[model samples]
Target: ELTNRSFEDPPGSSVTPSGWYDCGFEGETPPDILPSPTLNIGKTAYHRSTYLGLTVRDNNTWESISQELRQPMQKGACYQLEVYLARAHSYWGISRITGKEANYKEPALLRIFGGFDGCDGRQLLAETPTVSHTDWRRYVLQLEPALKPYDHLILEAHYGDGPMPGPNNGNVLVDSLSNLIPVDCNANPGLNKNPEPEFAKRQMLSPKEADRDLPLPVSEAAKGEPISETQLLELITTTAPRIAFDPAGNLEHSHYTDPLTNKGKWANLLLKNILDGLAQHPLAILVIVIPEKDPNLAALKKQNLKEALVDLGALQEQVILRDWLEKDVEKVWYGNAESGVLMRLIR
Candidate 1:
């Protein structure tokens, strides 16, 4: 970009080269960003040969990875974020740092449009925990469009504490960038499907037959009327741990994203209204009226909330509603029936 008048890093380094990527020397090439301290990964992760390389500074810190893709997301539109991540080093002993060091947590950061002019797009969406093991894992996250339209996108990864683990602590590799307006279902599902041992229970709490019920207790906090929020919170506090043992839906995003979606215009208003009704009591059940045109609505109505720790402190034990065929598919129900009347849990 020397003669072409394109952007370059802030001085002190060699002149900009004509290539697909520009590494950080005295300073990084403008636009193309770095996710870490050292810039030396191969151009691509699973390419025929070499992969872009970057240096990891410490542990539990996030490195922002971004690109100069000039796509302006509308103010009210929704967008999905997706990328692939893997542990940098294969050998454990060869890692940069281990526990209790600088890069302690080995965090990975996937950022979007972080440091660009005009737009304040520091949307660091997804994070991978301290990765001590070696093996490539793909992670995807969904982000709402910023209030202002942004042209650039940033991707990043961070090390929590010290250096790579004792020869074993190594760099985390991230690649396969995919985002934008293209409606790719696999890219922006807002869910992590593979974590070896998924936190999802087989199903939500379901009744054994049709009228099974498990209700909450009366603690004299209120009269013989409806349950109180303080009492409900009290019950949840005692039961969060017990339910955590059999976590079903998303534990993290459920609280973080779900609530916000309900309030936003981009979200499904019908579904939000149904959920609002169920919150009246401790046990909430919601049913969706599916139309024939939207066959996928059946699938979407089901909540396979694994890592988000959904349905915490469910009154009854999570019952797996068996199907007639009993194939690969399984069903579940949530309910509470100890409060005089056996009220089934809302879906």
Candidate 2:
């Protein structure tokens, strides 16, 4: 079994978790241990109290970790391994190339290598496709080293064959590694399959049509039904214009002047409607639907709207952000960014 396989560390600590040696580029900082109060990017652990955060910097230097394997990986022997991976929406760092702060928010792939010693990446064993999801996802890799037996394993973050520009900023979360299970070398590992968890339990509270195929919640809120969901949605959207995000994830027309009020659109009418609804029904909640494309950009959109709401006096806890998964993958490039978000009031 792998030591500290879950990448456990003290809560909110940035030190490297025990059992793994930093394999980062020379003259650069080591990989960070995350969810610290200062690094507060809201990345929760996939298995335990903490997880490993690695980045591929814009300067072309990436983060990695290495450890000695308990047993040698024999040549021609197929091994199946499972690992959990994710992409953080906000991984901030200073760019060595430009001398400015940058968000390492792009998606990067995880590569595994086998070698004889420390940080040895001489033999490429297996690699997962770019991990773009914000939630914890398990990836299974089949490794069969054609070369000689090796005793060390190195995990690296590298820019695989992606269309993005060279040497861009990206990050990947690592946690909950599984032991390498020996398998028949002749047996086909087949295609890589990523099992998506059942749709979130918060779907019932979303503004989208409830008839869509998705898992439902187990129970309802305890508050008395002071305002129906329909009534609450109507009240909030009555004067509030639909908000959309631009290609850069910036809010567009969200603050256009209302002909009657001549003020920030959301600042004046949208905020009033939300506060008014809460006044009548204190148990009501605001749900902000965010798109599921570009984990980082989606996060940007959610943060922008949430900040707007909080700045205008809506209690932070009262606002919720739900991800909208676009079923048709082909439309990701062509879909309207404005339709990405839909606000709803639910109990």
The candidate that wins on lDDT is 2
Q: Write the per-residue lDDT of candidate 1 for residues 197-240, one digit (tens) a residue.
A: 12222233434422212222323322234455544444333332
Instruction: Determine the backbone clash count of candidate 2.
Output: 0
TM-scores across all candidates? 0.34, 0.56
Please identify model 1 stretches exceeding 4 Å from their true place: 1-44, 58-65, 90-107, 113-115, 118-121, 129-133, 161-170, 181-347
The TM-score, computed over Cα atoms with residue i paired to residue i, of candidate 1 is 0.34
**Maximum-TM-score candidate:** 2
Q: What is the C-alpha lDDT of each candidate?
A: 0.31, 0.64
Structural RMSD, model 1: 18.1
- How many pairs collide in each candidate, listed in order? 97, 0
After best superposition, candidate 1 residue 316: deviation in angstroms? 61
* Residue pair clashes in candidate 2: none
